[model samples]
Target: MELLYEEAGQPCFGLPSALATAYGGDLGFTTPCLYANFVTSIDGVVALGPEYPSSGSAISGREPADRFVMGLLRACADAVLIGAGTLRATPGHLWTPDHVCPQAAPDFAELRKKLGRAAQPQLVVVTASGDVPTEHPAVQSGATMATTANGARHLEGRLPAACTVFVAGERPVLRMTDVLAALHAHGHTTVLTEGGPHLIGSLISESLLDELFLTTSPVLAGRTDTARPGLIEGFELLPNRQAWTDLISARRRGSYLFLRYRLRSSCGLGLGLSAACRKRCPT
Candidate 1:
C-alpha cells in the first residue's frame, strides 16, 4: 500500500507498527464520529442489484488491499454497524477485522489491545421490519440488533442466546439518530457502518454521517433494467440538492484508489428540511 497524499490535522490513533505499515499510513477518527466504508465500481455502482449477492466483494474482486483496508477500518472502530439487508445479502460474512484479512490478524489484535478495545468490535444490525436472517453466521456468532417495537416482537425467542435485541423506534421507521445515540451511550463513540445503500440513505437523510472511505474499483458496472444502487441509495442528491464533500486523503494499491471524504456541513437536509439546514450550515 502507498499513500499518495493526505491532508493535515487528521486524527491519529497511533496504530500498531505492523498495521500502520501495511495500511500505508496511520488512521483514526474524531470522537463520536460516524464513518462509512464502501467499495464501488468505476461507474459509481456500489451494488450489482439485489439479485447479485456479495456485491462488494464482486466489485473489488476480493482484492487483498481492499480486504486489508476493510479489516483496518473494522479494527479501528468501537463497533461495526450494518442494516438487516446487508446481513441478509452476505449470509456467511462476519463484521470483524480478522475475518476479512487474516494475514493481518495479529496486527489487528495488537491494535485493539493498545486501544483497550474489546476482543472484537461489537456488531450492530439495524432493521425496521424485523426481517433479519437469524441463522446467518454473523448473527449466530453474536450481534446487537436495533429494531422497531414490532420488529422486536417478531424477533422474540428467535435470536440466539448470544444476541441482544433492542427496540429503537416505533413501527415503520427507525431513526439513525436514536440508534447512534444508543450506541454512543453504550461507550461506542467511534462507530463504523458497512450497511447497504438503503441504510446509507437513512443515515445521510438525517445528516448523521461524517466521513466516507470509498474504494474505487477499476471496473465499470453498467446499469440495465435492474436496480443497481450507487453509494447513496433511496434518494437523489443532485441539482435540487447537494452532497459536496472535501477530499481528506488518498491512497492506492494496484489499480484500486482508496479515497476519504468529509461530508459537507449542510447536514444533508432534504427539500422539506431546507429551512433547518440554514442553521446547520450558515455559509
Candidate 2:
C-alpha cells in the first residue's frame, strides 16, 4: 500500500520501517474519536449476505491491505463497537486488532502500550433486541453489551461474568448519545465501529460518527431483492440532507482503495468539550 493523498497527520506505529511503510505511517486517534471501518465492493455492496458467512472477506477478497488497515484502526481504538447482527454474522470473529492480522500482533500491542491503552481494546456490542449470541466465541470471551431497558431483561444471565450489560436507552429505540456517554464514563473515548449497516445508519443519523475509513474492493457484489445492504441502512441520509464530511486522506493497494473522511461536526461535543451532551449536541 502507498499514500495517494494525506491532508496531514503523522500516525505512528512501532513496527519496523519496511513493515510500516504500507500503512503510510503510525496511526493514532484524538482523545474522543468515533470512527468506523468498512470494506465494500465496487458496486457498493458491503456484504454478500442475508445468509453468506464472513461476507466482508468475500467482498474484500480477503485483501491483505484491507486487513492491515483494519488492524491498524483497531489498534488505535479504546473500544470496538458493533451491532448484534454483526456479532451473529461472524460466529468465530474476535474484535481484537491481532485477530485481523496476527502477523502484526506484536506491533499492534506495542502501539497500544505506547498509547497508554489497555492490552486490548474493549469490545462493545450494541443491540436494541439484546439478541446477541451468548455462546458465540466473542461473547463468551466477554464484551460490553449496550441495549435498551427492555433488552436488558433478555440478556440478564445469559452472558458470561466477564460481560457487562448497560442500558443505553430508556425507550424502545437505542440512543447513540447515551451509549457514547456510558463508554466515555468507562474511559473509552476513542471508538471504532465495525458495523452491519443498520448500526452505521443509526450512528450516522445521530451525527455521532467522527470519521469513516472505507476500503473499496475491486469486485462487485451485485444486489438483489434479498436485502443485500449497503454502507448505511435503516434510515435515509443524502435524501434527508444529512451533514456532509471532508476527505482527510486516501491510499491505494493493488486494485483496492482506502479512504478516510472527517465529519464537519462529530458526535456529542467530543470527549472533554462538555460533560452533558444534551447541552451541546443537536436534537
Candidate 3:
C-alpha cells in the first residue's frame, strides 16, 4: 500500500514500503544491527545550518517529504539511539512517546507477556562523558545511558534510578560496535541511528550498519561548510573489503525523494578458513 503526506497543495508518498519489507525478518530479535536515517535536499542539503531549527522559517525551504520520512522512521524503530551530544543539543519527545500512540508504539506489552516482564525497548544515549543534562525530558522519561568506564565513573552519583549506564569500554568514547552489541544483548535489536554526522560516519566506518533510509528534500542550502556538515563527507564507501549495498526502494513525496539501501554480504575469506588451508597445503 502507498502512504502519502500532504502539504502546500502537494501530495507525497511515504518512504517506499519495500524499504520496510527488507527488514521484515529478525528486526527486533537478536541481530546486532542498525539502520541509519538521513534527510537531505535534492541539491544535497541536510539542513540549513549547524544547529537544526525546531520549527517555522528555519524549515520553510525544506520539503514536506523530509518531515514525513523522519516521523515515520521513528515510529517504526524498536528504540531510537542518539549520541549524548545530539540529545543535549535537541532534546524533546524523540519517538512520540509510548503513551501518545498505544497502537503505533512497538507492542512492548505483548513482548512483556512473552518475556514474562515489561520489556520496553530502551531509548539509548551513547555518551563519552555521561554529561547529559539531568533535567532533559528524555532523562526524566527514563532514557538509558551507555558510556565508557570513565563516563560511568564521572556520573556515578548523578544518573537517575531508571537509567542503565553500561561501562562497555575503557576509553572515554565507547566503540560503536560495543555499544550495539550491548543493545542487542539487552533485546533491542531494531536500532535506529539518527545523527550529528560524526556518529553516523563512525558507524559507517566500523561497518556496523545494515541499512540506510534517506529522505532527500528539494531545496539546496548550497553551502558546503555549514554549521552542521553533511551526513556523509562524500558518496564513496570506506575501503576495506568489497562492500555491497542494494537499493531496496524509492518514492517521491512532496519535494523529497525517500530511498532505502540494504547491506548485502561482503566478499572475503574468514581467518579461520584461511589458517586451516595454509596448514593443510603448506609448501
Q: Return the TM-score for each candidate structure.
A: 0.92, 0.91, 0.68
Per-residue lDDT tens digits for candidate 2, residues 33-134, read: 789999999988997775887899898888888998899889888999999899989989999988989988887887788778899999999988888889
Best by TM-score: 1
Q: Better model by TM-score, 1 or 3?
A: 1
Model 2, global lDDT: 0.82
lDDT tens per residue, model 3, 1-283: 1333211211122223332332221122113347777766555554455365532124334344454445445544566787776676664655432433343334434433343333444678888887888777778768888887878888787877877788765666678777877776776766777765667767766666666777665565566455545666423465754567777556664454666766553112111111122212111
- The CA lDDT at 167 in model 3 is 74
Per-model CA lDDT versus the true structure: 0.85, 0.82, 0.56
Model 3, residue 38: distance off in Å is 1.5
Residue 133 shift from truth in candidate 1, angstroms? 0.9
Clashing pairs in 1: none
Q: Considering lDDT, which of the candidate structures 1 and 3 is the better prediction for this target?
A: 1
TM-score of 2: 0.91
